[model samples]
Target: MTALVEMKDLKKTYKMGETYVKALDGINLTIKKDEFVSIVGPSGSGKSTLMNMIGCLDALDEGTYFLEGTDVSELSSSKLALIRSKKIGFIFQGFNLLSKLTALENVEMPLIYQNYSHKNRKKKAIEALEKVGLGDRLHHKPTELSGGQQQRVAIARALVADPPIILADEPTGNLDSKSGKEIMDMLVDLHKQGNTIILITHDTYIANTARRKIVLKDGKITEDVEVS
Candidate 1:
């Protein structure tokens, strides 16, 4: 597999009151295309910071980050937003769906930024919703859906554009055990279908579900190992 993401000497620091917190400490890592990886850490372990760096949601204090060969570390916020919309799909723990939008409409959000015509967007959104088993609920608002269903909508929205990389941050954090397992299964199936998935979670079971796991502690990677 080709390298989809690469980071060398990655570092980020935040000033909290009188102390400086090192969110990422000289980290070096790489993720390949079609690989399923889980980044797991305890609270304050810099898991969120690392995900931000990888997702282009925030810049690093120091390091070189190459996403499919493009150096994104120093790109302007606007450029980073473009890269995010074009190259990455994000699934968050909170089902970040618009309250007034139906499942289909929510799924079409990403394509709107890409200037997709209304007809094409609707067609694609329906297909994505169907792919996630939400075809019957396309017109239902988020408030009318269950937690799992809402998350399915989010997943549909994330993949509607067919972005190469999926950055899922605690995707199942809000679901029940069964729903969480279902979501994880969906992610596994997605991985099998050739999407590079980067999952950020603190749950050991969830972390082990991936093909590889990277354990972080004190802003540094303590272990990088194959799941078996």
Candidate 2:
């Protein structure tokens, strides 16, 4: 089967005055459909750069990227936006929720962009919130919920689109241990349900939870290991 995501000799560099900083250097990777993978590294290790590349949020300076068999590096900006909307769901550590919107409303925001009918959007939002165990809290705002509950709202929003790939960056970084574990369990369940997940974190324990772990150092992949 073709890989869900493929990168070959990917490189990204940033210019700071007269110096050029390499964010990602010659990264080659393949993530299969429905596979749970984690990219872990410390600061300046290029984890974020790799995630940005895979998520189609940034264009690399060199190399090629194929998403679900299409060469994304060759796509236009408008096409890239369409592909991102259609293929990827993003979950961030900060919970990126609008302060004034209720959980249901926030989850419905993505559907709004997709031009979903109001009634259908509500139905899907409710189902997604419920999936994250927040059925009773749909009416609450982000400030009204606990940290874990807030993250759950973010997860619900990510799932609301039913995208094939879920990209979570430092998903548990802001939560307490109990809450972090809960979030991890939810991710594991989502993986079992056949959603391809790519997690980015600096935590070894968190990285180990995935079936495959890719370690990065100094903008290069240092190790790629599959756990049994």
Report lDDT per candidate: 0.94, 0.94
For model 1, name the residue pairs that clash: none
Residues 1-228 of candidate 1 have per-residue lDDT tens digits of 457899999999999999999999999999998889999999899999999999999888888999999999768888998899888999999989999989999999999999899999999999999999999999999999999999999999989999889999999999999999999999999999998899999999999999999999989999999998
Q: Model 1 residue 70 lDDT?
A: 90
What lDDT, from 0 to 1, does candidate 2 have? 0.94
**TM-score winner among the candidates?**
1
Candidate 2 all-Cα RMSD:
1.0
Residue-level lDDT tens digits of model 2 in 80-183? 88788778899998989999999999999988888899999999999999999999998999999999999999998989999989999999999999999999
The per-residue C-alpha lDDT of model 1 at residue 89 equals 92
| Superposition TM-score, candidate 2 onto the true structure | 0.97
The estimated TM-scores of all candidates read 0.98, 0.97
